[model samples]
Structure formats: structure tokens, C-alpha cells
Target: MSQTAGVKPMAIAGRAVSERERCLGMTDAERAWRKQWLKDQVLASNEPVHVEELWRERTNPIRRFYRAPLDKIFSGLSGVLGAERAATYRYITGKLGLLALGILGIHYYFKYNGNDWTKKGGWRVLKSKPLVLPGQEGFPYKSDRKQPSDYAERGFKKAAI
Candidate 1:
């Protein structure tokens, strides 16, 4: 009477027909018959099909299993070098290490040698005058920002000479 009820019967019938079709399609005799039909269609001659010969002629076994010699060489080298050496080599070759080393060397040289522009002596030179900067008042080095008065007392001007 209702549309929903009318649709239920059609749905049930459709499911039953699909199930019947699936069962019919799955029978061993049906499979055998289909195989025989396919074999008949594919193989015209009565002689046995040489699947291996066909595969060999059509597909390359060497290409399927082929590997580049360099890949093997690198893998072997990795095994020989061990993890530490490989990681070290990778790090040393990277830009970060070089940049870091350059920064560190510059910092060390500047810290010890002192910048030429500032006229502030190196650590050894600072021992006598103790080069004090503008902002640094109590601190010894002219570079110290805390001692602002010492820089003024030392007549330290910010202008580049």
C-alpha cells in the first residue's frame, strides 16, 4: 500500500536473484566449463602450452632481478664504514658544520684579538687599560654595557674612527 512497503518486495527479489546468480556462477562445473572455453579460445593447437617459453620470450627475467652495481657498492661501503663514520662524514660535508666552525673561529678570534675598529685592546692589551665601553659603568671591559659612566670617563665615542 505504502511506497516503502512496495519497495521492500522489489529489494528482496533483487537480493534473491543476485544470490542465485552468484551461487550459479560459483559451481565447480561452471568454473571448469569456463576454463575449458577459455583454453579452447586461446589455444588452437592440441599440443601443450609452453608457459615458461612464452614468459621467457615476452618478459625479461634479467631486468626484473637487475640491480645497479653502484647501489650495491654504496651499501657495502656503508656496512664497512659503520654508522658513526657515515654520520660524521655526512655532518662534516653539510653546510651547517662549516658555518658553525666559521662562526666559532670568528667569535674566538674577535674575543681574544679584539676588533680593530673599536681600538679596544685584546685580552692582553685590556689588562693595562681595561677598555671600557659607553654603557658599562662598573665593568672592566669597554665592551661591557653595564658601565655606562666608564665609557664616558674614558672619552669613548661611538663614532667610527
Candidate 2:
């Protein structure tokens, strides 16, 4: 039996489609071309694919600049630590570096966005007041003038008199 015999023709919009067109939701001709392309790439080159390089090429120049030159760093490590250990360390360090970058990015995002240090009255911009101990003063502590807000008020009042 022919190759087309095994593939059942499918109908779309009331028209019969060829087996190749029905397969994998693509025209059989395109699928064959894609299969051929993969064979060419795999057979032609022994070099492994660097998908991240392609991604970097598509990224903004500023973002590319911020990216650590890990390849150079890892290459040096490979020379000193050997290939296998370097690969392991690279994987570990890469994950940790990304995590740190993410945390710092989030921290700066909050710090600058809608929470400027000077614009929002510095560090004490929050609505909540700090907790005061039963005997400790509230704030505005001075050597000469003492105006305590809590239980410490009685002591200050006596000292003032």
C-alpha cells in the first residue's frame, strides 16, 4: 500500500484535504520540509545550539549590558576547576545569580516606584507609629526638655518640677 493509503483524508469547511495537509494540522509538504530542515541542522553541525545567544540578540542593549559575562567567568573556571566541576558550579551560580537579581530588582522596583525616600518624608512615611515600652518615652528626646507620651510621662513631669 502507498504511504498516502494509511493517512485518512480529513474534511474542513466541507472540502476533502490531502493526508499531508491533515497530518499535524499542517500541509504535508510543510511537514516534510520541516523534517528535512531538522535533519540538515543536526547532520551538518556538531556544535550544540546556544538558544540563550539568540534570546540575547533579541533583547534590548541595556538589558544585555546588565547581563553578567558568565561565559568568560565560566571559561576561566573551567581552566582552573576542570570541565565537569565548572559545569556544576556554573549551573549552581547561574541559578543563584538570577535569584539575587530578581530580589534586587523587586526591592528597587518598590523603593523607587511610588515610595521615593525623600518624596515620602524619608524613612518614617508609614502611617503606623513605632511601639513604645511602658516606661520608655515616645520621641523628640532632648537633654533639657523631656515630654514623654506613655508611663514615662509621670517621671518626666516629676523631673521637670
Residues 1-161, candidate 2: write the lDDT tens digits. Answer: 76578898663322113555456386576667666655665643535655987887878988657545775788788989997798888779888999999999878765655433235433323344466656688554334434335332323434533
Model 1 stretches astray by more than 4 angstroms: 1-77, 80-93, 115-149, 152-161
TM of each candidate vs. truth: 0.21, 0.32
Q: Per-residue lDDT tens digits of candidate 1, residues 62-85?
A: 743442343354446667787557
Q: Candidate 1 at residue 41, lDDT?
A: 57
Whole-model lDDT values for every prediction? 0.56, 0.61
- State the RMSD for candidate 2: 13.5
